[model samples]
Target: MNKRKIEVCLTPVLLPLYDIENSIVVVIDIFRATSSICYGIANGAEAIIPVAKVEDCLNYQQTDCLLAAERDGKVVEGFDFGNSPFAYTEDKVKGKTIVLTTTNGTYAISESRKTAYQVIVGSFLNLDAICNYLQKQDKDVLLLCAGWKNKFNLEDTLFAGAVVTQMGLDNFEYDDSAYAAEDLYLQAKDDLSGYTSKASHGKRMQKLNLEKDIAFCLNHNLTNVIPVLVGDKLVKM
Candidate 1:
């Protein structure tokens, strides 16, 4: 029997199911995590190693990796950069190894490592690239959303909808929340942020004066890099 592609929405409240034995895990944290990775790879970061904790990223700092981490929308005390796309630049990141840890996205990715055959990070910036890759692969793909502090967020779900819609999967099942996200994405169409930013995480980022970041995260297909997790790092493919 063909394995089913799963769409799992992960929040701090819902327990993480990272048992990725043979599936592809597409981790989505649209507010910043995936967006930053996309920026880093697009701007020329040779590879991004996504660690579960700041210490893991730090361990690599002595080696070839440039650390980038954030907690609660702020830079971690000792990382090289925070979880912001703006930090990645052609001049700074080109040919560099970026080690990243984020409050939600990294943790979600780490958890997904258990079950996914391959764990790939996803964002609106690389939407088309991700979809195009998935279309050619035969594995059952899982869409994992890194929700805010254990609560469901709209932006990640909308991204999931955008992905599933574009893939045109024939055998798919949506839980209540997944269906809601799909419906919301359709309702919003091209105005993604307007549709999903109603979530607390989006509002909090905006409150912190990051409306531009929100807009940037909502732009579909702006980048061509597909960040795939290799062993412990997410590298451009």
Candidate 2:
């Protein structure tokens, strides 16, 4: 078995209880947040400043950066954008710095950054980038899933599984949570979009009339941008 250990944090609520110090934390909010961040970078954003609260993002907006804020899966009032990948088009975010606040993803990122030795944003959009980076870091990993409103969500958990399975497969031993995530991912590997369509969060987005986003978030390895935390900002590595 490989010596490296990887743990998947299925939800953000449990982040406070975990001892993640000195470990690599991969934050996943596949439905939108991280995916949007990746798009923002790949499309050419200089950096992304992830804030937990809309007010914090608002504070940054005075600095000439684009702001995107979301609350409960919808665009927050008076923000330039919401937590949607398509909203981060080249015409909008390219060559600019963005301040982003999402309901769950950005909150999880702020929380996980507290003690993680290194924090990297992950999403299906940059899946291969994350897997390749983990292979080199050689540290214990915690896939911090930004679950829907701090509760467990299938899409995030599945992305974590994709990471673990890609980085080493059965070569490394992991906790029950990692195993469970892997199992779920394997079951859905052949049809990720189809599988995730049934998820609660998926249904939630559908209610919001964001059906195209669900498929966009599931598209894999489209970009090689691996967003790494560099002094309170996420920039491409």
Candidate 3:
């Protein structure tokens, strides 16, 4: 059997340093973006188109798409929704195509487009599905963290560690980054929501009165929706 390698890139800025040409890239934006993707798809959204910029999302306005745009934790004016997980409820998002843009998450997806062999969105909501999918691939796995503003953030790094821990691959080769992430996850696995609630991003969200969104994002395996990159949009597998 071929040895599979699992690695963690703490931030999108480090993606260029890795040879991800044919690797499985798991994009994690645990705070809201990837989490919202899970909720939206679970609630019956047709598909999600993640754009890197607000201007890119405007084109979708011509259609019946729901536009979710966020920058620096605030919903952009004139957009249909914000990055909050609760914003994607069954009644509102059902049967609609969502066009999304955010400060970090969408950019990470766009970055993985041409380089990665496969791109899968990861959040606590679909954590199990992501790990199960990677185990079956038997390919080198790279957990790409959609850190705040291309800078390292605790929540995303913790999510990377959680992935490494969940993968639990005996034959897996991982680097120091992965080692650190795994250790962090092991230390906090028992009270994941409590541990993450005090993170910087968590604090930021809390100040915005988004405790509900934070709680939803930190829940484990709430959904099995694994959003995979299909051309330019993300669709359920």
TM-scores of the candidates in the order shown: 0.89, 0.96, 0.96
- Better candidate by TM-score, 1 or 3: 3
> lDDT of model 2 at residue 158?
93
Clashes of each: 12, 1, 0
Please provide, for model 1 over 1-237, each residue's C-alpha lDDT reduced to its tens digit, 9 standing for 90 to 100.
553565656463353443457667788999999888888888889887777787777777568768888888888886778887888878889999888888888888888776568888899999999988887887766788888766777788888888777765465544555566667678878776676677788778877898887887787788888888877777877
- Best TM-score goes to which candidate? 3
Model 3 misplacement above 4 A: none
lDDT of 3 at 98: 93
State, as a TM-score between 0 and 1, how close model 3 is to the true structure: 0.96
Candidate 1 or 2, higher TM-score?
2
User: What is the full ranking by TM-score, best candidate first?
Assistant: 3, 2, 1
Ranking by lDDT: 3, 2, 1
Error of 2 at 173 (Å): 2.3
User: lDDT score, residue 217, model 2?
Assistant: 91
lDDT of each: 0.78, 0.88, 0.89
